[model samples]
Target chain A: EAGVAQSPRYKIIEKRQSVAFWCNPISGHATLYWYQQILGQGPKLLIQFQNNGVVDDSQLPKDRFSAERLKGVDSTLKIQPAKLEDSAVYLCASSSNTQGANVLTFGAGSRLTVL
Target chain B: QKEVEQDPGPLSVPEGAIVSLNCTYSNSAFQYFMWYRQYSRKGPELLMYTYSSGNKEDGRFTAQVDKSSKYISLFIRDSQPSDSATYLCASTLYSGAGSYQLTFGKGTKLSVIP
Candidate 1:
């Protein structure tokens, strides 16, 4: 089975600019997640989607970040007016909604650089 | 205090040695524990998963969860150069309806030198 797919593996933009990353989860997977990994830190949850509806996004910086999963398949995470702190790797992951399962399959991730 | 704490070590060990990694958590509600390995510039992949507390071993890797002390450990025996990567410890409540949040430690970097 194909793993989760993310596009624009590397992106460079000036601070205060806008950037968007895309993710295509594995087939039959119902849970999709967006995580940010700053250098020397673990991936932090930015948003989570179960099917087409959001399950959690409390850690998401709403004022500058927005995400959507349309039709419950594909997802997009956008950061507007990016900050220097936004220079990090954006990872997309998916997992089957099997009862009591939490294993997540991840994409290669999109690396972002804010200059 | 953070929900989870891990030592961010660029720990170096000779090949064929034993490696021990650990993380401590503050939430007793986390009943599921996991260890993920991530290479440079790559996303993390699950290496082990444990339900509640106990020891689960897979080949050269062992995962131990002690809910009583809120501490978890991952041990790699006869470590190889291939084992060089960052190991992250994560814990969460059972992934079910209305509760899917995963709390992760900062991650420990391990290198097995040949």
Candidate 2:
């Protein structure tokens, strides 16, 4: 099976600029997640979508970070006015089921660097 | 205290050696324990998953969880250079809305020398 897919393998921008990353989950998967991983740190959940509706976004920096999974298939994460601290790898993951452990399949992340 | 705590070790070991990675969590609600392996510049892949406290083994890897102590571990036997990567420990529980919240520990970087 094809794994989750992400676009713009790498990006660089100055602080206060904006950037967006795209993700395509595995076929038939119903759940999608966006996670941010800083250098040397574990990935942190930025948002989660069950189909097209949001399941969680408590960790997202609403003022600067936004994500949407439209039509319940592909997702886009945007960072406006990016800060130096916002530089990190954006990972996309998907799961077929929500029951039990719900093992996730992840994509090679989109790396972002904010100067 | 952090929800999950792990020592970020750039641990190095030679081939055919035994490697052990561990983590601790403070959340008792976490019912699922998992281990994920992440190569550089890539996303994490599931290495092991265990629900109940005990031991589960798969090929050259063993996963151990102790619910009472809120501890989890992964052991690699006959380690090879291919086993070198960052190991992340994660814990999760049902969080309503048909979703679960997974919390991860700081990954331990392992290097296996052949």
Name the best candidate (by lDDT): 2
Model 2, range B1-114, lDDT digits (tens) per residue? 889999999999999999999999998999899999999988999998999999999999999999988889999999999999999999987766677778899999999998
- Write one digit per residue (lDDT tens) for candidate 2, span A4-107: 99999999999999999999999998889999999999999999899999998999999999999889999999999899999899999999774689888899
Tens-digit lDDT string for candidate 1 (B1-114): 999999999899999999999999998888789999999989899998998688999999999999899999999999999999999999876545644667789999999999
In model 1, where do residues sit more than 4 Å from their true spots?
B94-99
Give the number of colliding residue pairs in candidate 2.
Answer: 0
Worst 10 residues of 1 chain B by lDDT: B92-101
After superposition, candidate 2 runs with Cα above 4 Å error: none
Q: What lDDT does candidate 1 reach at residue A113?
A: 99
Query: If you assessed candidate 1 against the hidden native complex, which CAPRI class would it receive?
Result: medium
TM-scores for all candidates: the values are: 0.97, 0.98
lDDT of 1 by residue, A22-105 (tens): 999999888899999999999999999999998889899999999999999999999998999999999999988574647888
Positional deviation of B102 in candidate 2, in angstroms? 1.6
Question: Which run of 10 residues does model 2 chain B get worst, by summed lDDT?
Answer: B93-102
TM-score of chain B of each: 0.95, 0.98
